[model samples]
Structure formats: C-alpha cells, structure tokens
Target chain A: MTALAPLATLSRRRFQLTTRTPRELLVPLVTPMLFALVIAPALKEALHTGTAYEAFVAVGTVGLLVPLNTMFSGLSVIVDRENGAQRELLAAPVPRSFLVLGNLSVALAVTAFQVVALILFALARGIDFHTGAAGLGWFVGAGVLFAIGMYGMAETLANRVPKQEEYIARVPAIAIVPWFLAGALFPITALPGFLTWVARFLPLTHGLALMRYGLLGDASGLEHIWSMGSNTAMAALSLGVVAVFAAALTAVSIRVFARTALR
Target chain B: MIEVRQLRKVYPGDVEAVKGIDFEVAPGEIFGLLGPNGAGKSTTIGMLTTTIRPSGGSARVGGFDVAENPLAARRVSSVVFQEPVVDRSLSGRTNLELHARLWRVEPGVARQRIAELSDALGVADLLDRAVGDYSGGERRRLEIARALVSEPRVLFLDEPTVGLDPRIRHELLEVIGRLRAGTDLTILLTTHYLDEAERLCDRIAVMHEGRIVALDHPQRLRHELGRELVELHVRDDLPAALAVLRAHGIPAEDAFSVGSTLTVPLRDLSAGEAIATINDLGVATAISAREPTLDDVYLRLTGDRLAPAA
Candidate 1:
C-alpha cells in the first residue's frame, strides 16, 4: 500500500497541474466543440456521407478530438520534464508503474467527459441508438480505451520532441487525421482503393467502426464488436487491442523519458 | 549520509558532463560542490539527486542506491533546483501543497510542515499571493521552504543564491544555517560563490571539467595548498614577475595575470618573506597578503581563477 501511495500522489499532482489554470481546459473542450458545431457541418457534403451529417459528424468529430486532446494534454508531461517537475515526481518513493498508469488515467478522464458530451448531444439531436443500453455501454467503454491508447501515443511524442511546436505540428496529424482516413465521417468503401487498404492498418478505424455501429446500427456488423460477435468476445477483443497498444506505447514512452532524463 | 562513487554522465555526441567524481558526506555536514561555469556541478547534483541518471558509476543516499532504488533514495532527499520550478499562477502555499502530495505526506502533517518551513524561510506572510508576485529572492526562499516540507534526510541545493543581492544572499544563507542546525539534515550544495561555500559548507569539493580535483574540510583544503596568495599591483610585465618567482624555486602554479594586478601564489613562506621576494624583483609598488581562502584552493586545483566569464 505504501508503494502504491506514490502512484496515487502522482495522479493527484498530474491532475492538479493539468488544471492549474482554468484556461488549460479551454483548448481541449472548445476545439472539439468548434469542429463539431462549425467546421464539421460545413464539410458534410465534402465528406460525401448521406447520414444525418450534423449528428454523424458531431459523434465522429468528438471521437477525433479524443486523440487530439491526448496529444495536446500530454504536452504537459514535456513541460514538466523541462521545468523539472517530472524530476520531482520521479524522485518520490513511488512505483514507476504507478506513475505511468496514473498519468494515462488522468488523460483518459479529461477527454472522456467531452467525448460523452458530444455523443449525448448527437443523441439529443435525433441520432438513433442501435444497440440500446448494451451498445451505449460499449460505446463509452471504447471511448475510454481509445483515450488510453492516444494518451500513450501522445506521451511518447512528448518524450521524443525537443520543442512544443514540433509536437503541436505533428501529433494532430498522426493521432486525429487517421480518424478521417478511417471513415469516421464517410465510409472508407467510398475512398480510393489505395486509402481503403491504408485504413485497414489504423486503430481508430476499428474504434470508430465499433462506435458508429453501436450508435447508428448502420455500419456493416462485421467490424463492430456488439453486433457481429457475442458481446463478451467483442468487449474482450476491443479491450485487448486497447491494452496491447497502451502497454506497448507506455513501454516506449518510459524508455524515451528515461533516456532524455539521463542525457 | 550521502555517498557518490565514480559517478559520470556523458551526453550525446560524447560530451562528458561528469567524469567519475567521488565523495562521501557525513550526516549533518554541509558539503559544497564548488566549480566555475560548465564545471559539471549541476550535472553531478542531477545524477546524485536522481533527476538525471548516471551513464557510469554509482551513488547512494542513506544507504539506498540512487540508481537501483531511486525512489527510496529520493524519499530521504529533496532538491531546491537552480531554476525556479514553482508554478507562477499558484499561491506559494498551493505550490508547496502540490509538492507535499508528491511525497505522500498526510494533508494535516503537510500543512504543519508547510507552516513551519514557510515561517523558517520567512515566506509565511506571503503564502496567499501568487508566486509571480514574489521577487526572485522570495521565490528562491519559497523553493527552499518547499524542499524542507518533507524534512528530507539529505538536502540538495544547486546554486541557491546565484543572481541574488548580497543582503538577501546573506539572509538566505543564515536561514540555511539555521535549518542545518535545527534539523539533522545532510546538505549537498553546488555554488560558484566561494564565500558561500566557505561560510556554509563544512567541507568543499573543487570540481574541474567534470572531475573532483580537490576535496576536504574548507580550512584543510586551504592549508593543504601550503601557500599565501599575494595580489600585487606592479608596473612590470606580469609574466616576468611570475617567471621570477618560479626561477626562485617558489611554485607559483596558482597564479594569473588579471588586469593591472598580478595575483600570485607564494609557497611555504610568511607574508614578510613573500613581500621581500617581490621587493627583490624591483617591480612591486604595492602588495597585500590576505588569508588563504577557497578561491586560492580553487586556483590551485583548476589552474584558473573564477574570473569574469571563466
């Protein structure tokens, strides 16, 4: 229990620093809302989707924003490292595993609320729920796991990049643009054959597929976990992917952090 | 107690910052890591405090390994980093609380410790104001206060008084001295100010080019050099004066020409004898013998003085 205390403290500190100024929350919350209300609707035709473009994009945009927040929020780790706060935390008598897990948990919590809000708004705007309560549970669960994966990816980026601007420029494209190429707005079947092939390798494609089918009941059932397979199997598989990705990225992130610290 | 054995850190592209330095500090002793700019004092502190990993060698704090069990090592250590790491937007109390959380002290205990440390550091009156409103010296004091909240077994202070006015530097040193006496704190500090090292550190290590060149109690370090430093303002070629002293079999290795003054080392001689030797050279107008200081010891080891921009 004492060994776990540092991890608890680490989580508390990271969350405190993330919320140090009320202004820090604005970018993560406002950017997604902006794309959802303004930019997303305008691109409805350009996206070439016949679904209720407004609600479809709101859900999709919110999903994309999770990854964006992951990258942007994770930049705080870089700031802490440079400013020596990371050193303060690392030096505490806490488990290293706790530090990593606690940080990802905070990242997941921060973005999950906004993602759910956007989903609720879409539902309020007459987007039908396909899988009822069961599907909604899966949807929320997928959002949480996706947030975990993106948080790990973002932390890794923060460890590697020298300047905040470089990360700012790179991670959005790496983490969010994949959502577009994965058919978050328009189905990937409509894309050029080359891009469809590319989408197969993307994690968000599977995630959005799971999410859209759960929400609209319109996606091909093969991809979404709740529909094509038994609910338990789909849940297990989605969580397994999330666990694998988060674990791998976290390992890489720790190494990068340790290297930079030593250097 | 603190022990650092052959600790070295080499940066990328083979820039060796700390090169296998060794030292041990006893409990309740203030040990100063004295060096000029780029002399690896900060790098060495970083490694010892667990902020930066050592590329080679090892260190321990309170019998715990810094590398193998850094958290346990750090549990007994705290650092007031050279740069101000306080969040400018947060109140001083809030800043200290955040650090308190990292160390996992109960909130009630943390508050009591914060109150004690803040009062000791003289920042208790300013606890509610944001740190941004505080002056540089105040910020430094607050950082010291933060480091003290944990009541660490070993305290690492990196250049704690740099860029400070003499009065505030003195006050801070006094505060540190009080802390050292009032608590069983083993302190390791790095500083370029010789006076600070002489006054605060029980023992000092003169670091040069990432290596420990000399280490001993401050008084012993001075006596070991066996020299009285004499600064002479003479109207003669400085190098010739140095040469004349060397020719007379006086080892003046810790000597340098600074402006119109030639600061030279007179080995194994009384002040009168040193003056007579300079008189024999027939170029001395005025000369003075100050008691040997850490500056002289630094000069002896590094072959250079802490001059402007060295």
Candidate 2:
C-alpha cells in the first residue's frame, strides 16, 4: 500500500489537533518575544557582541522555543494513551512508522510558522539585524530542522516513557538543559574550556548558531573553533550538521516507536 | 472469520494470562468469550486484534495471521475496547470521518459510509455536536460507528456495555442484536453479563483461569445443569433433608445448597414426584420449580461467581 495517503491524512489530523487547541500555539508564538524583552537588555553590557543584544536574544529565543515547543508535542502521545486514543490508532491498518512521521511533520510545519511569526515579532519589537527575505527563509528552514531533530528525540521518549508524570519530569534534562549548554541564552565561546568542548557536539549548539546566522547576519560568530574557513563556509557546515541531526534522530525515533507501541 | 490454535500469552514476570486455548468463529456468527475479569478474555482479544504480541501459538483474523501480517489483519477487522476511545474534543461526524481517512477510505465513500453508520448506530442526531457533550451511551454509539466506518469483516467488542446504566446497556444491546440478525459481519464480543451472552451469541466459549472451560451454544451449556431445577427450602435440618431426599433415590450429591434453599436438578423427576417424595417424608418446606439459566451453567463450570469486574 502507498504510505503517502495515510501519512497525509494522519498529518492532517495532527495539524487539526494542534490548531483546535490554542494553548499549544501560545508558547511558540509569545514566549520568544517575552524572552527578547526580558533577558536581552540585562545581558547587553555584560557580554559584548557585534549585533545588539536584543537581536542576539531574538535568534536565541527562536532557537530555544522552536525545539522546546515542538518537543512538547510529544505529550500528546501520553495523553492519547491515557484516553485510549492511541490503542484505537495502533489498531488501524496504517504502517506504524507513518504515525511517527505524521507527528514529526506537523510539528515541523507548526514550528516553521512560529519561526516566521517570531521573526516578525522581533522586527515589531525593534530588534534589527537582517531585513532580507532570504534571511527569513533561512530562519524558517533552520527552525524546521531544529524542530524535526528535537521532535524525533521527543517521540523516542514518549514511546519509551511509561507514564506522563515520568515523561514531564524528564523534559528539562532532555529539552532544556541542552539549550543552556548549547549557548542559546548567550554564546558558547563565553563558556569555560571543558564546558565549551561539551557544547560543540550538541545539535542545539549548531542549530542555535545557524538560526543566529540567518537572522543576525553574523553567523553567530561561535563557529571559529571548528572552522578555519570563511564565515559562509562555516554557516554551510552548521546547516549540514543540523540536517544530519534531523535525519539520524528521526530514523531512530521511528524505529523505536514502531516496536515500543505494541503491547 | 477468526481462528486461534494453542494461543498463549505469558506477561512479564511470568504471569500466564492466556494458556493455550483453541477456538474458531465462522463468518457472520456472533461468537462470545464469556468470563469475569482477569480470566484472559481481554488478553485473547488483544492478540487477535494485533495490539498484543502472542508468546506462543497462533491467531488469525479474516484469514490474515495476526503475528505475521498484523496490518493485513487490521484492515479486515475492527475493535471497540472497554475503554472510552472517541476523541471528545471533536464532533461525532468528525471522529467518524477521521477514522475513515486513517483507514484510507476514499473521501466520497467515507462520507457516505459515515452517514450510513451514524444513522444505523442511532448517532445521526448527535453527529454535529462535540463528543464531550454526549452521555456515556451516546459516545459509545459514536465509537461503534467509527469502528464500522471501514466496513470490517470481523468486529471485536470487548465488554461493550460495561459502564452504561441498565437502560442504556439494554439499548446498546438492541443495537448489537440488530447487527446479529444480518450475515454481513462476524462479531466476537466479551461480557460477564450472563443474559447478554444468553441473548446475543450464536455460540460462546466460557473461559476460566486462562482456558476455555466450556464452549457450546448457550442453551447446550445451560443444559449441563438439567432442563429445570427443583428448589427445596428447609427451615432447619439440611442433613435430615438430604437424607430424606437420598432415601427417595435422589443422591445427596445431586443437590447443592445456597443459603436455606437446596437446589436439586430435575433431570427425569417430575415436580410432582419430588413434591410427593417430600410429603412422604412428612417434612415441612417451601418448594418451587424454574428453568436453568446461563448463570447456573457458569457457576457449575467454575465455582467462582461470574462477577462484572476484574
């Protein structure tokens, strides 16, 4: 059987579920701007950067919020399990992997929309760096990839975690701690020598750096440790790393969810 | 149609839920797995529905091996679990159409089938309202409509009337009874409700402690107790009553007591002979005669009362 039709239908349902509930959309849309307003000025003079700190915080906010909000979508799995909807869906004739993909795709699209809205919100808030349409396009791409990679990790947790209480207890370690270590609140170059090394390997580091490059037009200036090449080549390298992150984690999550969903 | 052979499921920590039971259901038949909670009725349904992996043996649904070809098996069958599964946030029509799409029913055909199934299930009037607004029985009707939207060949209902009030339960029963009158669908339902099994199933397999203790037409199973039961009440002296009956050629083993009443199976004895024998003994007691029921059949097969809960 063709997987396209069912995946599309399931994706549509996920999208419908998301839109019908406005609270899920709120964190992605409003929380980033709140961060730009509240945290950017406090760190403005403490850390010197090429762009205004508000601009830096704008990309950081988007970077952190996009993945965090998308990952939270995994909570739906637990809710469906409690309510018996998951059993109904599992008994359907569709391939199990398609269900994982459907969840991933809708998260990507919703976060992509959030990316655009956040950019416009930053502009309206008077945080200026890049005004080009192509830059906004790159921001959306980075947000989508960031969401994809993190959502994959979330699905793995959702399928494997036994209870909602346990899953929520783990959200900080899995989704939040990485952002702090990855320099979403600031630049990783400010971190200590050993902590900097730890930050270099995280997908969130590159994802946040890539998003800054797209919106701030300075490549976040945090890529020098891994690159001796020009800034453009550095940006391309960050994009490649984030793409690999998205693909690998998504593949693993689909496999894990397929086996774990059965009783 | 459904078939199972030597099916077993040993849960983690070595809890054997279903132990090598065998049965088959013909197409268009209303087969039942009757047992109280934890008797492995739900576990057997889980295996046949492809939600649970079988530890050993085999099961097939609509000719597809559940373990080897679960998706194919799922395509030809549907299940209504004991748990409430309909999405309460959405309207009944939306829920039905959503399920239709997941099963890849063509959009046009899905719409038509949604309409038909809702009308048939008596949920047509409530289709436009969100399911959260529905009563328990209404939501159940909508769930059944959603299961039927794909037009499955085999339908599994696991305790379909468990939580409903009596009036609503019988109402749902009538809905299912109507489905049983037709030959287009095969149904496998589980219920501890004796009267439901007695009224609905073409044949039932009475399960106890993970095995099929009895499998036959409901009437035949009840026949194990006898055509009718002779009820004997003694104010006191049950042993004397027993001795008196045994002296009249009715063995004490053939009669059992519940409270003050001693129930004697009226195998060949007419009510008059039993009454005359009691009079011959010059004993004072109250007596009555009644037909045997499925409750007696289950009690005879398994000493435990067939309760509704796990």
**Per-prediction RMSD in angstroms?**
3.6, 4.0
Model 1 per-residue lDDT tens digits across residues B127-181: 9998889998999999999888888999999999998899999999998888877
Clashing pairs for model 2 are: none
Q: Where does candidate 2 stray beyond 4 Å?
A: A45-50, A130-141, A220-227, A230-240, B230-266, B269-289, B304-310
> Which candidate gets the maximum DockQ versus the true structure?
2
CAPRI level of candidate 1: acceptable
lDDT of each: 0.76, 0.81
User: Residues B1-310, candidate 2, lDDT per residue (tens digit)?
Assistant: 7999999999989999999999999999999999979999999999999888899999999999999999999999989999898767778888888788887788899999888888888889999998889999998988888988898999999999999999999999999988756557999999999999999999999999899999999998878767777777776666677776777775345455666776767777677777777766765478887888888777656552212210
Displacement of the residue A36 alpha carbon in candidate 1, Å: 3.5
TM-score of chain B of 1: 0.91
In model 1, what is the error at residue A81, expressed in angstroms?
A: 2.6
Q: List candidate 1 stretches off by more than 4 Å.
A: A38-53, A221-239, B225-227, B233-239, B246-261, B267-270, B283-286, B305-310
Q: Tell me how each candidate scores on DockQ against the true complex.
A: 0.47, 0.59
Model 2, first chain, TM-score of 0.90
With a 3 Å backbone cut-off (N, CA, C), the pairs that clash in candidate 1 are: none
